[model samples]
Target: MPAALEESAKPVIIGRSSSHFTRVTRIFAAELHVDYSFRVVRDLMSSNPEDYGGNPALKIPSLQTPRGVWFGSLNVCRELWRRSSPRPRVVWPEDHDEPLLANAQELVLQAMSTEVSLIMGKLGGTGDSAHHTKMRQSLINMMAWLEDNATSVLAALPQPRDLSYLEVTLFCLVSHLEFRDVLPTAPYPELNKFCQQFAARASIGETTFGFDT
Candidate 1:
């Protein structure tokens, strides 16, 4: 993308730099060649919907666009795709009709949400509660399942595609677990390998997760 055009079309992306969901949309924006201005949400616990770009759900990664406010990563990514002159071939969640592809997508998102809950609980000083303990165990179980199925799940994805939401989210989920120390990711070799490969992309490199200064 050229600098002049990028500046002219700069959409405002509201979210924390460290958020996996936010990173997903940022990656898509980069891939789609849609330059955006990032607005950092300093406090994750802020009750103001304005903090989340008019998202009533108060979630990060909401896109403030000329058309309107998009309230989720997927929606933001789709909108970005639509705005791109030459759209890349993208495989969305709805394209996963087979059980293997569909289940993998489901599990990846579930794990991401579960990680969010666990982290929120810890930050709220409820890390030692029984529910937290159960959530931890559930996370452990889900990781194990993902590790065991990683090979087959990835193999089942459509070939010759520019990108897939399944792969992007899986990469974010696995990498975020390691990044936040929600779990030790060393045991999931397949997922780790996948991340190693995916991390080489320019889109992924530009959006490396970190705290905003």
Candidate 2:
């Protein structure tokens, strides 16, 4: 059995609450029944050595585990999966074309996230205009392809009710996109529907959307 959630025993999550990456980790932790305490590390836009120490890339969702510090949301999730009883497996199918499709999904989601971040910066009056235009074009192109292709990709994958890292990452991306109002929600109706369904789950409900401090 996993250790109980003692005050001092909780793993420290070295990131702010509002970060989608951090939320993904938190939600996974909740699912795995891994107790954690979140520490607010603000000023993500600044390049500070201390901030980089936790996650050399200065990314959010770095975990301070008993073993040591683990970086990256996905990496932390994997660790949590390992620690959890009845370990979770990747939800994508093995026999079909799921591996490639999953890779494409992740790539598009990453691009979409970057675009939304740029758009947020622009709206906040702290972004470069040229970069914003370029990112917006890229986002639009990626979204078009995602909308046109997601159904086929999903069709190839096995249907499992339990959430996987892929689903968690995808959920965070879609929620962040909506929260930032980067794209019209109606355009990606299928993705939006998936998000709505996923959001109703206890883990997701516990990790509501917000911008990190």
Give me the candidate number with maximum lDDT.
1
lDDT on C-alpha atoms for all candidate structures: 0.89, 0.69
Model 1, 152: alpha-carbon shift in Å?
A: 1.1
Provide the lowest-lDDT 10-residue window in model 2: 1-10
- Over 103-161, each residue of candidate 2 has an lDDT whose tens digit, in order, gives 65566557646854776577689676887777777777776666676667656555663
Output the TM-score of candidate 1: 0.94
Backbone clash total for model 2 is 1
lDDT (10s digit) by residue, model 1, range 113-165:
88999999999999999999998898888889889999998888887789999
After TM-score superposition, the amount by which residue 47's alpha carbon in candidate 2 deviates from its true location, in angstroms, is: 2.5
lDDT of 1: 0.89
Model 1, residue 69: displacement in angstroms?
0.4
lDDT (Cα, 0-100) at 78 in candidate 1: 93
TM-score of each: 0.94, 0.81
